[model samples]
Target: MFNRRQLLGAGAALVSTAAWSKTANAGLPEAAIMETAATQPPLHPQSGPDYNPVVTLNGWTLPFRMNNGVKEFHLVAEPVEREVAEGMTAYLWGYNGQSPGPTIEAVEGDRIRIFVTNKLPEHTSVHWHGLILPSGMDGVSGLSHPGIPTGKTFVYEFDLVKSGTFMYHPHADEMVQMAMGMMGMFIVHPKDPNFRRVDRDFLIMLNAFDIDPGMYVPKVMTMLDFSLWGWNSRVFPGIDPLPIGKGERARIRVGNLTMTNHPIHMHGYDFAVTCTDGGWVKPEAQWPEVSIDIPVGAMRAFEFDAIYEGDWAIHCHKSHHTMNAMGHDVPTFVGADKRNLTKKIRNLQPEYMPMGTAGMADMGVMEMELPDNTIPMMTGWGPHGPLEMGGMFSVVKVREGLTPGDYSDPGWYQNPPGTQAYEWTGELPEPRKAADAQTQITPRPGSHNTAG
Candidate 1:
């Protein structure tokens, strides 16, 4: 198994260095860089909570909890908010009013019945992504049947055909409804008698969002502005802190329902990709890959043998998303000084800043300059400006060694830094430029830089 984060870090370093040297030697004007920056809009702002719906299986009602603090999944076909960038208070759709929906855990052969109530003011339906069900039960609104109208209820009955990680979300108006926060994770366990040896299992749902109701009204989506992102809803670091033991072999099932592909990066361990949407791969197909590119509408399962002990940052590989507030503008840099007048100043108080922009508002919502040897440990991924959007993200802490203990309170595990406090230390790392000297350079056939 290859640790996904380490491999990607190395690849990014190499590519960045190559790009830098090529541009530097070409003597491109500085204006080119500025022009590129100006053409690029800031990252989107993400908000809302995970979806935690109550399910009735075999006449038993079980409440599925969101891994973090996600509250609901708002499913609407029409535009509820009048604008895109403003007035978009963190109102979202959820499983029982939570984002990331609920985590459904079931054993093989169990028949599960889920009742989905549509509270939004429009029509919608739930598509169980990656599940091998009959097409009529696929829940694609028009394709499956007329969608569940507002104030009506629909029954979703299905058997656990296979055992693995799966997901659910509205298939109609997918781009907008999903963007508005309507999705969740569903899991099925193995039925084999020999498959009961696992210690701990977890589910991670990746998502993204856009806008800051506190700073500005949410903006309407033009073709160019829909790029705001999140993971499970909030950008990483801002969503919730994930804690794990130092030396535990954890089985993590990851699902991606966002619009783009995510190279989910986990630190300190190389794990085996044991299963995919089509189910477990053959023994030969199971190999080591650090960063697996999970395209939209796909899922994967892997077991990582945690070897190192430290607080590690896990997120997407897209550099812009990893650094700031879903790529939105940092309030401090936008107009902090001018907006600091009495009444507005109260709004500018440190506590008033939105999720990702606390404390470091004065540094400007752009790239941060840091020492060469310093490696930033980030909690969330997004831009430093408004429309704070990115997709499902989180962190993983691998302890040095494991001890026998209960599932919830495994001893020797330390909570991540900044769990109790929120602070904006500085600007996020800039996308590596194409002209930096630290980049790796390959020698030409007759160049003098070649070394034996």
Candidate 2:
């Protein structure tokens, strides 16, 4: 409740003139800001209906206060410095104190009041994506209401008609706003606490940034060829692992705000798609899947029982989408002869080295210096060795005895004796060649081999 605008007292500009705007200015609620990129503990409801809270991957949920019969919340749209990883950070437009703003969670059929303050230089508006509400509170800049001008506050009041995964983003100058990372998840838990319940619920937001290797800001005009793909604005190693206790039923909700689709793949479990932005799929309609492809601007929720225990890899299946910075323009050097090129280049720069002739796997382990504030294209290390992974990647740490509420890392997994893959040194055999002659048996005049 302590904001410079609120300090103005009676002089503070009231929200734009609408029927609902005439309601008593409750004085702007405090806009809570998170400073760290680490995932915070779930915000357990102190007084409302009982439902397991959602763990936002690398984010947090906004808190609300009970005002009369309605739940009141505040959101501030401003510029922020967000850590993309430990070493890299981005200057982005966001809500509260982070890019991809804090999630707003409430129960179905609950009447809520939201106060959105615009701190950016330009005017903005918030669209309650995929939520059923009055047309006037849709947050569209022109059609439904006027933009919230800079340094001004606006109010949106509506009832949560249904419960499902939803989103919030700017409707004014959408291209520029969204590209700057002005978005967040909106969750409406079912009023019935046991409805489609799970032991652990999680939220992930998929996004991408097109910053050059050392820059701090994204190129807003980039339509494709993004350099850094992210989950909740954080890349691999930076992304928090999903920890599940053995036999625990877990649900993960993913929202895609990026320009392209992401086929998210999990290593060990085949889960059922249980919900989407439209609503929860009936139990009979749910289907099993190992890789769920989330389309642009859509949401997906999947659940599985954590019967197996270990460190399971979870990431996007698109090869390039899982890579980090400075690769799209890098030419293919695999199977190429770089010896002559290396010799010639050494004449000018004596320390120049040849790489990637065999494969880019070397990039993962090579300590070749990178420019300030960037990550390798293919990076990460695991229990075995160099993981050769980057963007949109994280592990799902499933173990037998993890404490129900603890989200701490349990280190690496220790495979039992005889369970790990070992070197096969007992046999020597001739490498087989394909039946080349038989393969060409149907060849016509255009292609031929002498053998018959």
Candidate 3:
């Protein structure tokens, strides 16, 4: 009999396609595809929005607001277009048009008010992962309160009781919504003024996707499906490249919301783990580590002072996820090639010749047979077996002495040694003399105040 892990993995794999077919046949409406003709009237862009909202933390004011808000002031969830596979496009709900929404930055002891507005046809709520708060405000639809209804709004007010990086996502139909891209980062900074300042900071949330174009997808819960893809939302090399400069101290906030565990690896340096979902570890609890395992629905915060300068890759250490389909006997391409082969043969080709059937053979694509001599059976859950591969990966580059200003400043241009300079002028009016400027003053008591 197969073990439970194997079975769970297989079930998880099939959930996506199964859910898609079920939803389609049930006549559920299709989610609007990114960049496609609008299926419904577009919402009037958020009006008179506050692009910037102020949050007071530990008596310090920090800038915090949801992105993609009309004019940048409110939290707005909208549909976005993304390439799920070659020649395939899928629509995902995003904050400010990004799958993993904007990063909310705050210091410890800050009161945070997140105003979440639902734009989808369904009800949704925001869960503050790992943050200690009253259960009523936890954002679980049934457990916390009725979820925010479509076109309505809800406010999540909480305090940063601890300092660390956490995440936010929909608790209603989470497996489906999260896979569809309703998630973002939340960071609580330490109140200590003497904390080490890093040269740069970045947020990375690892998730997975089981999507086929033009269909509704569901969350894969069993381990069977979990094996096919590691991280649903591919971060490194899929969306944007992670950048680091040599000798720069980089702080990375990582969160894992996938179904399975991800043993994340960062090349070239062993960093210090400073915090977790619960908050900063005591001095005795701190330790040095290079790679860490992040569990589902948890967050981990670590700091790495770069020592080497190169493009170092970070990814899940699961053997199959690192290798494409584990050499499964699946076809690599579909459409024209598959059609031509089928036409030439006057019938369907070999079991593995059809598109989307690669990696399903009893013998591993590597030709390795099962130890028991039984033909390895393939299921319709995930891409292949529990050991399926290729998700949740990224890279970090560290270079020597390159400051943030070095890359962003217009006048101070620096190219790798021996590279030519590329210059461009910015379009902005030059500053005028103070004496030539017009001034308006509101009269009130003590109006005679002047700068020393």
Best by TM-score: 2
For model 2, the superposed segments whose C-alpha errors exceed 4 Å read 1-26, 428-432, 437-452
Question: Comparing 1 and 2 by TM-score, which wins?
Answer: 2
Q: What is the per-residue lDDT of model 3 for residues 50-123, given as tens digits with 9 covering 90 to 100? A: 12211111011112322222111135566665443233344677654445565566556656556566788788
What shift in Å separates residue 218 of candidate 2 from its native position after superposition?
0.6
| Tens-place lDDT digits, model 1, residues 249-340 | 56666677765677877766677888887787776888887777787788887777566665555667775555333434434432123333
Question: Which has the better lDDT: candidate 1, or candidate 3?
Answer: 3
Best by lDDT: 2
lDDT against the true structure, per candidate, is 0.49, 0.86, 0.52
Specify the poorest-scoring 10-residue window by lDDT in model 1.
30-39
Error of 3 at 356 (Å): 15
Candidate 2, residues 1-452, lDDT tens digits: the string is: 32322322311222212223345544566567788788877877767798899999998888776666677778999998989987889989999889999999999989999999899999999999999999999999989999999988888999999999999999999999999999999999999999998989999999998999779999999998899999999998789889889989999999999999999999988999999989999999999999999999999999999999899999999999788885566777765677778877899989786887778888788887778889888788898889898899999999999999778788888988988888998877997767767664343666533210
In order of listing, the candidates' clash counts read 96, 1, 37
